[model samples]
Target chain A: MKTRIPVAVAFLSGFLMIVAFFGSGEWLSMLTNEALRYMTIVAGFSLLLGVVSITQVSWGVVRKRGEDWPYKIILLIALAAMTGFGVLQGITGGTVFEWLFDKIQKPMMATMFSVLAFYIASAAYRAFRARTVEASILLVTAIIVMIGRVPMGQYIYEDLPSVANWIMMFPNVAVQRGIIIGAALGAASMSLRIILGIERTYMGRG
Target chain B: MANQGNKGFFTRLQNVDRRVLFVLIFASVIVPLFFPLKLPVPVTPETREFFEAVEAIPDSSIVMLPFDFWPSTLAETEPMAVVGLRHLFRKNCYVVGLSNVGMGGPSIADRLLDSIGGEFGKTYGIDYVNLGYKANYQAVMLGMGERIEDIFPTDHRGTPLSEIPLMRRVPNYDSVSFIFVVSDNVAVDYWVGLVNSRFGVPMGAGVTAVMAPKSLSFVQANQLVGLMGGMKGCAEYENLLGYPARATRGMDSQSIIHLLIVLFIVMGNVGYFAAKRKAKVEG
Candidate 1:
């Protein structure tokens, strides 16, 4: 009965949305918009679920004195402090919340992101070998694009940037469009299956 | 076995410690900054298209702008957003900012607006309004096509849209001249698919370098009118705007880093081929 009720609800809602797209009826459109709003609200509420999960995990780690309990405690403290500041002073209230975000949050995020450049450089060196025909072609194209996209590329040769643009505009676009079309078809099929109740995996049972 | 000694050098190079490479990359990015290369910046067609799109918008026309990126991508995507904002304000276009990505988005937008809007002496709720971060961008985009006020009853500042002079006049996509989405992800796709394709509102994107290649397809398919890809793209836009700024300044470091990566690839290949030749000789 539990599974049946959810399936029924899903089917009805999904079909209504599909109908709403094709149908011009005012109520159907209104119903679709309302459903979308509800979905948005539900999405907003899901952040609370995330907060709960994080709190549970962090609290458990602290309680157990796990491997990184110190860090867990810090995380909880930071989370609590930031949330308290945000709620108390509004996000744009610009004292504690802004300071935490700018001084602590942003710098940490930037530091983590900056690490990617070093790793990508190292990875490119280790992995970009041209032992085979396909690999050699890829390596050469990559080198060209890398150079052509930068200021130094124009210094190397006048036509380097033009060649790079040609590659990106033609071959790259073709491949990407193919992938997009394939994914769209797959998504459409999946959506149809879900609407028809043929796909029950999302219901937590096959 | 005569060539064994030469093979050791190549093998060692192939197995060089990554820390050494990291140092080299770190130096490559930093050393170039102290000594600026001052290389001539070339404008790409994509960036030119983006500039022209902004330039083509008639004065007083409202542009729908979405800040759809995280702080992590601020380095690459934020510059484009800032420059784009500056150009829009300079052109006397009414700006409406919103975000569906997260709450941080609206704050980021506010910071940029406050910084740039002050320079132009633009007043809030009159010349521009930030609807703030909504929950579902797709729903917001689609709903706004029908009626924007129904979706966002108030601006980010809690002022009613009706009270806002700009919002009262520009209610929906009918009044919005362009939809500009700046994101690290495919949030531009939502703008393109839901708003552009469905409602026929023209759109463009400023995306991070990692996501730039994928966006080329949208530009090619005429789905997006223009695109700004990463720091280089931003630099190009700055060049076109005749207001060279951070994006231009950062290109020297970016150029050096690209050259270093190419150097690493070349060195790795040289070592690889040397080791292969030695193995072939032994066999």
Candidate 2:
């Protein structure tokens, strides 16, 4: 009975959305918009659920003095402080929430992302070997692109940038289109399966 | 003795410590920043198309700018957002800003709009309005197709859209002349697939360099009127605008890093081939 009810709800909603896509009527459009609104509301509630889940998990760790419990405590404190400030003073500029975000979070995130450059450079040097004809072709292409996309590339050769553009425009687009088409078809089929109740994994274990 | 020394050198090159490479990369990035190269940045066709698209928009036309990136990608995406807003305002276009990204996307857009809007002496609510972040971007996007106010009843600061003069004129996707999506993720796909394809609104995108290759197909299909791919793309846009900012300044560092990586790759390959030849000789 539990499974049947949820499955029925899914099928009804999915079918309505499909019909709304094809049909042309004010009532149908209104119904679809209302459904989308409800979906967004439900998604918003999920954020609250996430907060609750994290708090519970972190509290449990702190209570038990688990490994890295201190970090968990810090996380909880940070979370609570930010949430409190956001609720009390709002998240706009000149607020504590915005101040913390700008001063602490933004630079940390940027720094973490910047670290990837070093790893990418090291990986390229170690892994990019011309052991075979395919590898050689890839290596040559990489060199051309590396030279062509920047100002230095133009200095090295005026036409290097043009060659890089051709590679990106032609070979890259051809492969990307093929991938996009295949992925779209797969997604459509999967959606149909879910709507038809053939995909029950989302319903959780029996 | 010469052959022995050659073998040692090749082996060392093949097994250079990763820490050494890290230091080199760090130095490459930092040194260029301290000593600016002011290299000549060539504008790409994609960036030119993007610039021309905004330029072609009639004066006072309404445009939607979606900030769909997080702080992690601010380096690549922020310049795009800044220059895009600058260009839009330069044309005297009414701007409606929003975000599909949940984490800090709204805040980023709000800050950019405030700073850039201040530059143009533009008034809030009259010249621009931030619709802010919403959850379930798929639903938020499709709902906006019918009525934006339906999805976002209020501005980012919780003021009702009814009070915003800009919002009063913009009702739905039909009212938006163009959408310039600044993203570092797959949200661009949703904008292209769900919004542009469905509503027929012409769109352009500024995506991270890593995502550029994948986004090229959309540009090819005319799904995106123009595209800005990473720092280089941003630099190109800045150059076209005759405003060389962070992106232009950072290009020198980027160029040095790229050359350094290429040099390392070449050295590694030379070492590999040398080792192979030595093995053959010994055998």
lDDT of 2 by residue, A1-206 (tens): 97888888889889988997778799999999999999899999999999999999999999999989999999999999999999999987789999999999889999999888888888998999999999999999989998899999999998999999999999889989999999999999988988898887888943
Taking the tens digit of each residue's C-alpha lDDT, what string does model 2 give over B51-160?
89888999999999999999999999999999999999999998999998877898899999999999999988999888888899999989998888889989889999
- B181-270 per-residue lDDT for model 1 (tens digits): 898877887887778887798888999988889999999888888889999999999999999888888899898889888988898999
Scoring only the A-chain of each prediction against the true A-chain gives TM-scores of 0.93, 0.94
In the range A14-59, model 1's lDDT, one tens digit per residue, is 8976776667777876787777777667767878888989999999
Model 2 docking grade: high
> In terms of docking quality, how is candidate 1 classified?
medium
- Against the true structure, what is each candidate's TM-score? 0.95, 0.97
Fnat values, candidates in order: 0.62, 0.79
True contacts kept of 2: 0.79
In candidate 2 the C-alpha lDDT for residue B112 amounts to: 96
